[model samples]
Target: MGELFNRFHATRRNRRRFWLSILIFSSTVLFLFLVFFVKRHEQKSLSYSQVEPDSCVRLHEVSGVYRIRSERNRGRIWFATAQGLYELDTLRNQWQRFGPDQGLGSDKVYDVAFIDEIPWAVTRRGCNRYNAKRGRFEMVAPGSKLDRAPLILIEEMEPEGVFFGVDGGELYRLASLQAKPERIPIPDGNDDARITCLKKIGEMLYIGIENGWLYAYDPRNGSFHRYVFGRPLSPHAYLWDVVLFKGNLWVATSENGLYRQEQTGEDTLKPVKGFPAKGAFAFALEEDGFWCGTPFGLWRYHARQDAWIQFVHPREKQPTDFQVLTLFNEKDRLWFGSLENGCGYLNKRNLEWVTAFPSLSRPNAAALAADDSLVWVGFGYQGGFTNAYSSDALQKIKAYEASDDILEQSIQCFTLSNHRLFYGGYEGFGYLNMATGEYDHYSARRFPEIADITDIAVSPSQGLYYLAGAFGVVAYYADKDSLASFSETRRYRTTALYAEGDTLWAGTLSHGVLVIDRKSGQLLARMDGVSSRVMGLFGRPDNPDLLLATKEKGCYRLQKSTLRMESVDIPDKVLPGGCQQYENNIMTAKGMGNLFWVGTRFRGAVVYDENIRQWKRVTSQQGLLGNQIRAFAQSDRYIWIGTYGGVTRFHKPYLSRLLDIVL
Candidate 1:
């Protein structure tokens, strides 16, 4: 009985141990299965979150004026700036801007015309009509005949008709934008000639061609006749403007000053006396006198006195030498639009000139970088630098000429890492420690071959820094304070560099991309599937693959594991489904979460949605400063765009999602 009881107890203990082992094994297996399932689902259904256009897109611009127009009463002024179209509230002294979201056809507005008190504009793309009731510029349909050509000039004709001229010197009359335009014949019959200006008086229409040709048309007779200036004007002279003032016809030329003739008597235009010899580019008619906008200054002519008075403010440090491009007159107020400085307003009663929308002399922004606290923009060549704490206000950062450590004044590229701001230029590379306000510089003397530092990349984990320029690629050891050659291919010019973990990718001007081992500076591989001129490279935040930007070839994705490259087809309304022809010259690229942003040479920036597998392009049509993008940088809430015109900060909530993963 004792042996049997002991055997029963041993059997029960063995059974319990077996069940315990089975439970442990099953639990482990279930946990592993759940992990695998979740990861797989996450990868397959990766969310490239999107923000609403209203809440996501914001533009920060340093107001650089392009043109200006005023109302008949001069109570309100509209400024066409490098940034966008702005309406100045004279009473409040503030500006209200209109952009793509507000219905602008394009943010880069070249000229504006008022038809029936409604503002219509000519942009880089075509013509747009402002619909005040809808609060947006209604874009003309792409199928319209006008869309086939670029419209450069727009003017309102008599009896509720609009007249517009295309770059090909084709003039069309539209009774209403909804209706098809009626083609008007030119005297020269040269469809390739560029139309520069147009004016109307009584039953006659005056047309100015860029090739120093002037024509007069009679709407009643439907006849075109060329106007002779009687003087030998250069064949290549540009006819800037034409105006009908006080029973006289006035014409402005780019090379040969100004000319005037009687409205219906003179067969030839006579040179206007007391005019600037260099030429007048713009003209405005006044009740008592006429205003002429010249390259050097503004000239006011009194018809009664037959005398000229010039307005200049060079001694007062004002924009006296501003190349006036256009002028508007309202009662006692004279508004002058400049090619460089912003618009100038003169109150004839007080003889006071107030320049509105003051801007940078040269705002050719080339490099951009931003953090949550500040945004930095570097200009091209000798353009200098500027920064802004708030995107709404950009202020110039003074040059550190007082410090001998500061070598290059013009910045070409910028990178911000670990509170250190790194800048590269034609001369060398330098860094500014943000926390300590300490600055240091390095010159080509230390790295003789690197005469110009085109790009800089940092690998914090390895404490390594890489520089790419005319000399190819070079690596620097922070601990040893020494530099070594990463690539000896000096013949191939390097344009950009990106560092990821133990790998460094260099984009060459004509040799595609080079992959190097950061640890040993070994050439691991070469990617040449795309065009030879690789403009930029960006690493995937979640994967080892890279997104490559190329010139004229669009973008491509390089798979790290397979070493296979495939072109990314960007679809557009004008392109075929598989075509990559819409703005293929990509300049820069950045990745945020599963979304990729590509900056192009002419088409602005494109945003790719990985989840939807679609792309949306943002340009001047979409409120960007300009289409020519130079560089891009991102912060927690904004994507900073460096453009040829200026820097634009795009507010993106998706960046916060990326920060959540990183932090």
Candidate 2:
């Protein structure tokens, strides 16, 4: 009986073991499936997060490169990336960036061009023209009409009109100041063909289509002719750029080396010898030689010898090489813009080689400003110092000699007018003479203790200059503008000051917007709808509405006398338009011609077209530093930017879609 019981127990035990094994196997399978699902979700989330940076964007320090450019003045370079449009600055081998929060038309600038001496920036939609007169942007047209979406390629027709190239290969021109744009026919044979390049040489309009076919149009006779390259190199001949140099037309292609056709010959193009290895992506004509910035590096064409000399910057180890896409000659030095890398600089006299600030990555600076007299760079900052560069040439001028305890050596804003140098910075206010280098401080006990002075504006109507700071708004008499601080009777942390006739508009950090009577230090009208942290203030010279950049609520268009406020919608993708910085929105405003450049803290910068009511953002893809902009200033030649990374400067319109696809 005992043996029979033992056998039954063993059988039961074996069954139990079999069931346990099955359970374990099922559990392990489930666990593996769960892990795989979680990983897939994480990857999707990471990609989505990259699509839009968090409100509090943190910039990581990468690397640095020494950039030396002989050119002193190019316009402030504007860049567009997957993130936004940015004003980059490069100084002391550092990089920085400025975007929407600071002040720009939009956060996505695809291309930029200069028309009527004004900058016209392209976006996904239409185009915007900078109105330097009113200090704002005026959209040339609404972009909604093009069924093609905003992938626009814009170029200037020299003195006046502008040319727009759509993705479908249709060309349109904003020839007149009419409300709507005019569409120009590209001749019947081209079909709805895509235009690869458009250039105006002397009196002829040159258009390049897919494959190696070139066409020339005589606007006077309405005659069109196609120039064919004898051999077929590119499946679709794509012309990238065309320029008139050395009595000949230099044509750059996507597959073939540089092609040249005599100005008199309408149908002949021969490849320039030395650049045989690669096709030209972008090129700039300097004195006698042509500087070719190909996908490889920088190449100089010696017209005398008819040869190409590739130039690369000197670095400690093997310097980072990139596809040079653009070139600018500042003060005789050469600056190259890379499509993937950043910018490159070569000092011909010193043979000093350098790249854009934060040179390790895509700090591509699209524009350049250069002059024999001065060099101004705009970029971001990496470690400590901001990326605003002032050439040793300008530093030698000794604008202000206030060698004595100059109110905070850190300069926030600087302006030179009528031979007088004005600086607004951490200290209070100061003035210096370019000739004498005599400097004086204006922050004394007489005025309420002011923290950092952010901005100083000289009234166009009145000679008086308005001082804005952390304290309150203060006005100093024009002629007696010495280092004497105003009496402490009035103190307000003012960030911006604008004047119209006798009325002065002030945007403060804590006190809302104040309209002060310039003559008397008394406040006239004050608006407190939003907070006192008014960042950007622009008084439309003709319109009664005042444009105010606020801290949280995007931008406000305040009615002149009524104080009625209207909120402007910032792009959903970009929030807190400026960098999500805890400090006061360190944005700036400058107007040249008809365009207004608004520098922001985080959103980088945007160009606003008051006429079209459009916005454009500049970003790193377009060759800006990063997106954290600190300040914006326009020198006689280039627009300057102060940022967290370093400094970057561009000489032309910058638009690169690759930045959006990449991080």
Candidate 3:
């Protein structure tokens, strides 16, 4: 009886053990399957920021307008309208604008002129004189309350001084309209006529009046020469503007194009075939010719052929599109200020249309890095995507499958370990495979939940991945099948994370920085008492410290849990995105280098020089299809820049430099 009872007990024990084993195996399989399924799903549904237009140019006011007075060029047209002032570069297909925002003044610019080497701008407040050599503008008006019109025609006149034709066909002068312009009236025969335009030649000031009458006032004698055209032309027609070119007086009328008379004695006014009938209003002097502004467009008077060459508004021939409001010549190009479309540029040689400036859809990106054949980009609030760039012969590949994950993923930092690429985003920690475009499961649903992963670091010694999120830091060991968690005294938002040697560094928005010992998983040091919240962190080259770029505090270096402030200053510079450490060098992958590069959200890439401590900016000036930098990677010697526009390469210097360091 005892032997039979013992046998039954042993049999029950064996059955229990077998059932337990089956349960354990099934649970393991289910966990692995869930992780795989989540990762696979994430790789398929990726999306990016929606592209849209933000603002428009305000009409009725000019933004930028001025005369470029340089050594080779004199009195080139420069103008500022509400849209912005632009310099017409005829050869190139663009316009250049300058101001206080671009560096100018607070008053609205109305007119610009040059006298000898001095330049002056007329504003509603007063006349501003400029010393171009010193790049300074100051109000030089002798008084206050100046007129709204440009009346001076001298080669070297004060900003506040102006000359004009009187109503009586005589010449009058006003000194410093800003201070209350008082007219120095010159007596004339026709006292009821209105003044039109004025010009100064040699020692005489020529004035055009409303009755088609012309008068030349000698500054020496204060006398006038009443020159009137014969009855063949309408005597009541008002004259527009006048100029002296090649020792001849060129008269512009309201309806008639231009009439020329020689400077020699007994010269007669004759109609020139070169001038167009009607439309021509303002006159701007150029290097080789004089530019005329009309309602249709700008016209250049070629002296050799004695003909007017019109450069109409640049467009696709939609007659009702944009209307030419004003025109100026800057450098060598003709700037046509428009009513609807901001502005237009005309090429000098071919007189063809170039392009227009458009608003940016997405905020620019910062630093971009690639490792293990995958690219990582750091952005804000909600982070972005990843892409792949192969250097050899420009192998273009998307870093993360766009259709794999949710469209809007907040990724701040990313790193690579062995064959896995990890990302620290807003929601959770995630990884991707190097060989196949596959992702590992990401979750914040586990116990001690971790949401908003700020930075990521990998332990080369333990082959473990460290993720820093809003709550604290978590370490995941794939090989050992172990996971450890570390919590701070209080919940804090992590900003940047990195690992150097055996120490791990995590930066936070409000708490400054946290340094941890890898083996013990213990907090070693806390870098607090900083001016602003930390935005990025990077490991210095060949140094044990990390670099932190703050929200408003420029940049600082942290070594051995010690803080070292940096002296670098960015001028009119705003740093975007976050930072990353790779191969002993620190980098900012967001839109901060050179000028910040734009790319795909998943894998925005940035190229920079450690020695120079400068970032690469992808700009239209550099021939990049677009500025959004998504992913970046280095293969052998080549560096690839993956962007929403497409993948670009910087091979020669970049590839050659890496070869030296690697081999």
Candidate 4:
């Protein structure tokens, strides 16, 4: 009987082991199938994220290089752009930019030159000298005679002399930094002509003027001679560029070919034979001969071949020949700048191209964000570039150019969450993952649908991105990868939004602000007396308990917890359009002070200082890039102003301290 019981127990144990092994094997097979399926799906969208950036969005390397000045003695190279000034750091091989924030007279810089190792910038507003010790610019403060006259040109000659041309038909010499400017009279028949080019060779100052006139003047002996070009050009063709190369005088003309000095007795210039005209504009010298930049392409005077060689042709490599504005010989590289977007250098040793300076790929810098080592910018709105640039030593990381890809949209704001860049634009709202670049924007193609986001904001503490406009307020939770939108009221025409700890401030089209609770989706408060079409709403770093709201007509300060509202202190001299004008739904500046900047259309920017309780207006009258403000980008230490003219960077000296207050 005991032997029968043991045999039955052993048989039962064997059956249990058989069933357990079968179940384990089936589970393993199922796990492998699911893993394979998920990975295959991820590969299609995420393959390029680890190795490269998107092919649709790329680093735009051009920002209109208008002038170049190399202060070799100080190992400093200065580049003038349509926006502002850039100083090349040879040690790091990077360009350090300076604009209106650095007290520059204007960002539309006409020329940049270093006299006596001190950098001087000339702009449409006037001339300014860099005070290295102060780390800013001081306007060559208008003297009594100038009377805020617009500056047309500046000329610097050897033996410690700098000359400036004013619009009142007067030439003044600034003897020294301290001495007052003294008027230097020119010869007869020159008052009405616009000076185009100024070249000083030995003691003779060669002056080229528009309306076909050239004058050679001697400042020491008061001797001068004037000549006019009657051939190869119209009577009004401006003498563009005059340079002394290979011990001979060469001049460039916009109408036809280059003019070379033919005889010692002839003050007249004759067009060089067998030279390609191509609308010569600027000159850069090489060891053998020289290079002339033109509207058509880049032409080099091959001294060995004695023929003009077309080095870079337009349409050969994506519209390179769109008017080469300036060229320079820096070390072993030949640097050339274009009228709009072609600014780069050609390596003489390897014959490769390198574009420097991290400016806008297009005209308007719509939005800006920083991710680790890369700074990303999105271009859109009026200028119609519909492009963006991510810069790391000016590499072409990605490009977004096709009609289907661009869709002519403009990015209004950007916020990063979970390694993804969430952007809102006039077109729509989308997120760009480092692992997944957006494509076919509206259709999306395997990606999630982009929200209808005309404007948006973010809350770092809550890990939430707030989406407004048409759909009301939508909160995207980054951690859960989910979206929670409060679409109860579609009537909320939210023009601006600001998210604090537990509250979200939404400024609407009317002169009212709606305060909402983040957790409950409850309407907390409502305030009135704000300007219509509320444009700006944000919490200040200095006072997190208060909110600042801006509108087309004026501004108001609101209490966060109590929902109290008050009118901002307006300075009498803030130029009629600022706190009192309608403009800017943007961020402000920190670091230097509790500073808030309001961008205007005609007035550059109106700034309010919380600490000092004061206001000041900045414009081209001060040192801005342009008077027409289009867009704005704010980083940790800089506020970027994008205008119809160009872009400018303003520094915030005390940004670090502001964080301490908020924390």
Best by TM-score: 4
TM-score of candidate 3 relative to the true fold: 0.37
For candidate 2, write residues 1-663 as lDDT tens digits. 899999999999999999999999999999999999999788656643343221112122223111112212444444443333333343433233323322333344556555645666565545666666764556566553432246447766644466777767777766566645666777655647887776677877788877566888665665777775655657865787787886777788877777887455657777766675467766677778777766566677888887878676453233335566556566646766565454556888887876443321222221112233443222221111222224321221211112345323455665555555666656456665545756666654444444476667786344577677766766656676532233432566677777787787888776678887766666777787776467768766787787877664557788987888987665545434343354324355554333445666555766566666666656443334566665554434334444555344332221113122110
lDDT of each: 0.69, 0.56, 0.51, 0.62
Q: Ten residues in a row with the worst lDDT in model 3?
A: 50-59
**Global lDDT of model 3:** 0.51
Question: What ranking of all candidate models by TM-score puts the best one first?
Answer: 4, 1, 2, 3
Candidate 1 lDDT over 66-155, as tens digits, reads 456766665777777554577766766656666555666555676677787878777766777788787777776456767635677777
RMSD of each: 22.6, 16.5, 26.3, 27.5
| Segments of candidate 1 deviating more than 4 angstroms | 1-67, 71-74, 81-83, 262-264, 315-321, 358-637, 641-645, 651-663
> What TM-score fits each model?
0.51, 0.44, 0.37, 0.57
Which is superior by TM-score, 1 or 4?
4
